[model samples]
Target chain A: MSQKSEGGLQEQVAQLYGTYVDMVYRIAVLYLKEPAAAEDAVQEVFVKLMHWLARGRLQEKEHIKRWLIVTTKTTCMDELRRQKRQSTDPIEAGDFCSLPAVWQSGQGPDGERLREVHDALMRLSEDCRLVMYLFYFEGYSSAEIAGMLHMNHSTVRGKLRTGRRRMRILLEEDRE
Target chain B: MRQEDIREYFRSQGPSETQKDRILAGVLEQYEQETQGEFHMCTKTKRSVSKIVAIAAVMVLTTVSAFAAVPEFRDWIGGQFGLTAEQEADLAASGTLQNIQASASNGNLTMTVHQALVDEQGMYIIYDVDSDDGSAVDVSLDDLQFQASESAGVFLYSIEQKVLETREDGVTCMALLTGLEDLSGQEVSLSSCGLTCRWTVGETAEIQKIEADLTGKDLWTGRPYHVTGCGLSPICVKLDLDGAERLQDSGFPDQVAVEVANTDGSVKTIQSVGSCGKETEDYRYQMFLFDEIIDVDRVQAVYVDGVKLN
Candidate 1:
């Protein structure tokens, strides 16, 4: 490759890295629940991107972004799966019910609600949790979620519906 | 309880500035480290390729008996032409050949000749040949003329050998012709500014095999390649090996087809891969093609055909 072309590609990569680093890291943190793991996941995503660029594989910018998100999601999922496999016992029902200290320290109604929502989210199935994150946090539509997850739109919509219903029920029961 | 209420609550509880700054800083630092490692790896690959070329050149210069007498002369020739020893040996073996290799850099073409066969009478006759292994080949042609074909928008050549290399702007082609005893029965004709000639002899179906090692690269990500004149609308085809589907898009009017055929006879066809939008730098919409199916060990190969459109 010519020096000019190589330099331009490097610049584009650096710019893209700067643009999506936050999104990637947040996705990782949400999935992994550990800041250090999230940091590693973000690094892994960028490393993969750099490899793609060097190999002349990354053709377009939008495609590159989509790839990074999907990869980050998958990597996070795989880490979760591995953790699940390593543990002999499944997480009990009360695992997510236990509130963090901050929530119980005489916080406001919003803080209590946030804790409830967070607990309810943790009780959800992995797929439902991912759908909720993509929808609520990532601002992805059902169609975009389906594309990102490689699932049918109807399937994602169903997951979203079921997740919302479960969360609502959990919160209502807490109110009672 | 309402969806809007939930959204409003979450928005109101948005991450604090400190949290956002910490997350962003961590991410940036990680990305920088990763990018540095990748740059190091790429430099290593280039160095390895250069080393292989150097070793091959040394082996050829030391072992070849025919070119031993003219050591200084050979060195001079090698230095003047930037020919490695292996490249020189291949050229010595092939009497006449033509080849082209193209690569894309800033929307321009970088062409290099690996081999050529020069005609004794005119030195302009060229025959581009295909090698079993897709690497640079040696040619015997001395004088060559290169001109761009208006019809095909590809570079064409008139050499001593009766071969034509069809190359895109940024690709390189190499031809090697060995055991050139007689030049009879071989005919060279220039129909279009680009050689509209067909392969008269040898294999009728030249299956150009391309192997992409995407082991480390994330397969879920979409990658787009410009495939013109595929004759059919882009249809994603699944290969037999793994049921992974890949997106295929036909740029403009040309049909683009991505098919995966495995030895096991399993086949999967990917639907619409992704949407296409106008590129940031150009007016052309960048197409998004991705492998929809996942959890596979690996992908063997991907074939894109633009022959029908041509």
Candidate 2:
């Protein structure tokens, strides 16, 4: 490759990482729950982005973002499956300390509330957690989330409802 | 916790800048390593070609009025599809590259098939779509249709369309179509909108293609399946699975990783060209196209789901 093309590639990759790294990491966290594993998934997803951009298959920015989300989910699912095969025990949310240091230490103003919410989220199933994350945090409609996650629309809605009810119960138990 | 709190909590959990930077650096390093490996493979292929063919390749590159489109097509193949120099030379010397400046106009857009290179495995066509008023124009595989002569029994297994460039007046695109049968010497026709064009498939140079019987083969998904056969081509890998009755699009095992173990003791996982799958009757067929035309001779083995097929 020429210096010019290599420079172009660097620029393209940096642009992609800058634009979507956070989104990819967030989605991976919803699926993987472990920060280190999520970070690894981020690398895999971006490597895919580099290959796609090099091939000129990525059409527009929106499409690229869509592809990244789907790829991240798939990568995390693969990792989860590998984990399942290696060990009979499933990866529970509490198996690892997924709470951030700030939330765990309760240092910020609403740190305790944030930690409670995190615990409640960790209690939900991965799919339910992902649907809730996309709907509430990402501001995606149920239909759009369904399309991105490859789930039926009704399933997405049901997951959202189930997640909300379960989290409410967990949070209420904490108050009591 | 309230929904607002839940959203805010997860929002704050995004990775830190240090973590993002570390992941980005790792990805860039991986890309560079893969790119260097490909560079070495190309260099090795060039060195292995016969000197006579190399000389003839040079001659054709410099002075071939009959092959006016060879240089442009060669550069496009090299730049976009990353064909090795030896592969490009073989295509030219074997008379497989065809220069067809055939054009057809529909409404305000004129579509011209600039050049085409065909082999028994697949066909690569370079074309241009021009708008009458220098407006933006685009063309996709869905907008076009292909038909081969009935005697050839050539069915398109998969097709990919890529826009090479978007000039002010129009866009240049490349369409790669892999087939289930031999395409060489078969007259194939294409139609988009109301315009139609035809071209005879050219003779191809010797290329490595592995045909394997996939009876009772299991995919990485561990599903009991019966694939009719497998074709390992220079540009793509074609797979036909029988008894895929009532399988939805999502049910097709698209993520079965295709890896090429090259003769150089390096394994290259084919990525990014994306795959196309078609369901006909009780069959699910797929073609995994490479971003570049690979030198299949360099591939020592082709593996799907860790099972070595060739």
Candidate 3:
């Protein structure tokens, strides 16, 4: 890239880091299931983006945003797989919910409710969690998420519906 | 638990303050590293490379404006800088908020050190520089630098400063500190090595900054005066204390009358005293108003915190 062209890329990279940092952290926390691990993944994700930007690989704002989300998910998945390989004991799927909650500090009922929602969200498959988070919290369309996740649009919609049902059941069970 | 409500709830959910600072600090650190080569605004001078090297020393959490011991000042400063409430709370809780405040006034210009918060890696300062004349004066981020006389150990990692706002009273400024050690507890001074501020009132519009000599001439508070001691060993001068403080700025305490009486009936008044806090208040080692090392004999009268000693 020309020296003049690199200016926009640098600006966008700064924007991505500032604007969507929390989004990246939430996604990483949902998959990695630990605070330290999640923070590390968030940093690694940005660092990777920087490396890409340095190499002149990133060109557009929208593309960089999608790349951040996708790469955060991938980074967490790799770490989880690495953790599983290291465990001498067999790790089960349900073990994720049972994993110690990286409970972020909040106050009162709203805080409690959000914690409950996050706990339930983490119990869903990483794919479901990512898709549902994008659809609801980030306000991404199924088609947009489909492209980012490289899944069929219908498949993304199906997961979103199922993820909603699962989260309701988990919260309701806690209440009972 | 409606799905929509829960979605909204999760949307509101974000990382904790600790996690956010950790993430942002890491990311910005990387950005600052690469961006320095690309941050092209302050790099026009021959000294630009060194200035860039200075800012490359350490990173200060971003700050925008306000100076010193005023409550209204802090509030305005908080709003101006991109500091979150959480970060302010953190700095307060860490005791960095109650930092050293120093001020200096030359005959023509007055500079006040409003707030300086130092951490392990750096310190941040908010200050105001006002000309008594109050015409056109400017201190760019390019001009402000930090140097601690005592702290020779710490090296400048990086310095990011901005002239936040300008008013007739003075120009509001903020500086980001990056260093190897904590500077909050230390006494440091601000310098404008390539200070370019000027008063357009003069016949030629005298550059106030050019008048600011970096060779220990202009201090943020008062010009530092050097006085030599007269002691008994060589019989040059005994009990003649050096490094006395002059009544210059608001930061200075009240002056004590110190005089070195010589056999020749010549007595010199010392402006400031050197004491170790509340205890061991020794005023014999006073800053005598002497540009040259004066040779005196015999002991002189000492005033320890205004209490005269016979």
Better of 1 and 3 by DockQ: 3
Name the runs in model 3 displaced over 4 angstroms: A1-12, A88-107, B28-310
Clashing pairs in model 2?
A: none
Give each model's clash number.
40, 0, 18
For candidate 2, what's the TM-score of chain A, rounded to 2 decimals?
Answer: 0.89
Best of the two (2, 3) by TM-score: 2
State model 2's lDDT: 0.65
Highest-scoring model, TM-score: 2
Error of 3 at B31 (Å): 8.4
Tens digits of per-residue lDDT, candidate 1, B206-281, equal 1111323323333222334332211111112211111122222322322234454443655444333332222222
Error of 1 at B200 (Å): 48
Name the runs in model 2 displaced over 4 angstroms: A1-4, A88-90, B37-310
Candidate scoring better on TM-score of 1 and 3? 1
Question: For model 1, how does the per-residue alpha-carbon lDDT over A1-176 read when each residue is reduced to its tens digit?
Answer: 11113334345555675566666765665566555666667766665554445445455666666667766765665466455546735444444222345564528656677667766766777668778877886688998876555554677899999999999999888888
Recovered fraction of real interface contacts per model: 0.03, 0.37, 0.24
Q: Report, to 2 decimal places, the DockQ of model 2.
A: 0.14
Cα miss at A71, model 2 (Å)?
Answer: 0.8
Q: What is the TM-score of chain B in candidate 1?
A: 0.18
Candidate DockQ scores, in order: 0.05, 0.14, 0.10
lDDT tens readout by residue for model 3, B1-310: 6666667655555666555655655654554454443232222223322232233222211111110111122433345444444333223322333323455676567776666443334344667777888675677666776665446764544566767778976787776654223332234467652332221010000000001112332222342432222221100112222234532322333233455555466665554312111101343222112111222112334332343333
lDDT, residue B244, candidate 3: 44
Q: Per-residue alpha-carbon lDDT of model 3 for A72-142, expressed as tens digits? A: 87567656655654664433333433232433454654666766776687678888988887888788999
